[model samples]
Target: MPYTTSPVLPPGTLRRSPQPVLATGDGLVLRPWRIEDAPAVHAAFQDPLMHQWHLMASGSEAEAVGWVERWLTEWEGERIAQWTVADAHSGQLLGRVALRDIVLADGLAKIGYWTTAAARGRGVAVRATATLTRWAFDAIGFHRLELLHAGANEASCRVATKAGFALEGVKRSAFHHPDGWHDMHLHARVHGE
Candidate 1:
């Protein structure tokens, strides 16, 4: 989908944008990524469990910094929204989830997420995704949210299901992963449905 941006706002005027940080259930919080999060994100990417479920491209510290920079830029423009999941009590970074490829005209977006090995099995991704989806639909007025996972990544498929996303279908060669083209299971949730 083609990207679109909202009109610029006047100085000192309330722009009515979505909140940058959201607190999730129990002990987790979802918020925008900060530059200081670079090291933690780099460490999370190195987790073997994370690598097993998600594709990770080799990169140096400079590349990771660049990635965060891009995310910040996108968030500033309201083109894409990403949230870093962290422990509500301690404020430790756990993972990240993003609502990207947004089409404001259609009220649609694609959701993507990943968690560090330490945060697995605690329902962090599921809670964060569900909370984010609700925020998107309610605050942003999005009507539909889609999640696509590699067919082989059963864990991610399970997360989508648990988050109330219905399995839409499986598309052959839907994504190009690090290994090669792979089949993907598409899932979606619609507002008030």
Candidate 2:
């Protein structure tokens, strides 16, 4: 069967350009990554959990700078929109979130996020994810958004659940981590879901 656009939009619509900031109130905001964020980003990537699930580890400030540069290029190309999740009160870097693999003509995208060790268990990832999820649906006109995490990542699975994404089952041997191929727990929320 052929795929079709949702009733809300015509067959070929591009996503809206990402805004400068997505404020989550109570002192957290999702903003564009800055060159100056390289150091903080480098440190966060050093966390043991980050390397466990994220696969790649930044070996130096230069590698972190390259990370930020890639995101800048992604934004320019409209393939991804990455944001620095930060504290509004202290401007501390909490983590990162992104809407990647956006297929605008089909009105769907994927969401990914992680939080610093200090911000873990504090709902920063959940709130940032929720904010981006709403923006992707309501403002960007996406019909569906997905969040997939390694099955071993209980913390991220919890975040996806808390952010209201319904568990859609696992994809066996779906991702390659440092350890080996791992199953991925896929979760999703459609428009109005």
Clashes of each: 0, 0
**TM-score for each of the candidates:** 0.86, 0.91
Which residue ranges in model 1 land beyond 4 Å of their true spot?
Answer: 1-19, 52-58
Per-residue alpha-carbon lDDT of model 2 for 60-165, expressed as tens digits?
Answer: 9999999998887677565678999999989999999998887666677899998899999889999999999988788767889999999989998999999999
Judge candidate 1 at residue 178 and give its lDDT.
67
lDDT of 1 by residue, 10-111 (tens): 321212464468887688999878888887888888777666557764366667777787777676455477888999998898899998886665677899
Q: CA lDDT, every prediction?
A: 0.81, 0.87
Alpha carbon deviation, residue 44, candidate 2 (Å): 0.6
Ten consecutive residues with minimal summed lDDT in candidate 1?
7-16
lDDT, candidate 1, residue 62?
Answer: 68
Top candidate when judged by TM-score against the true structure? 2
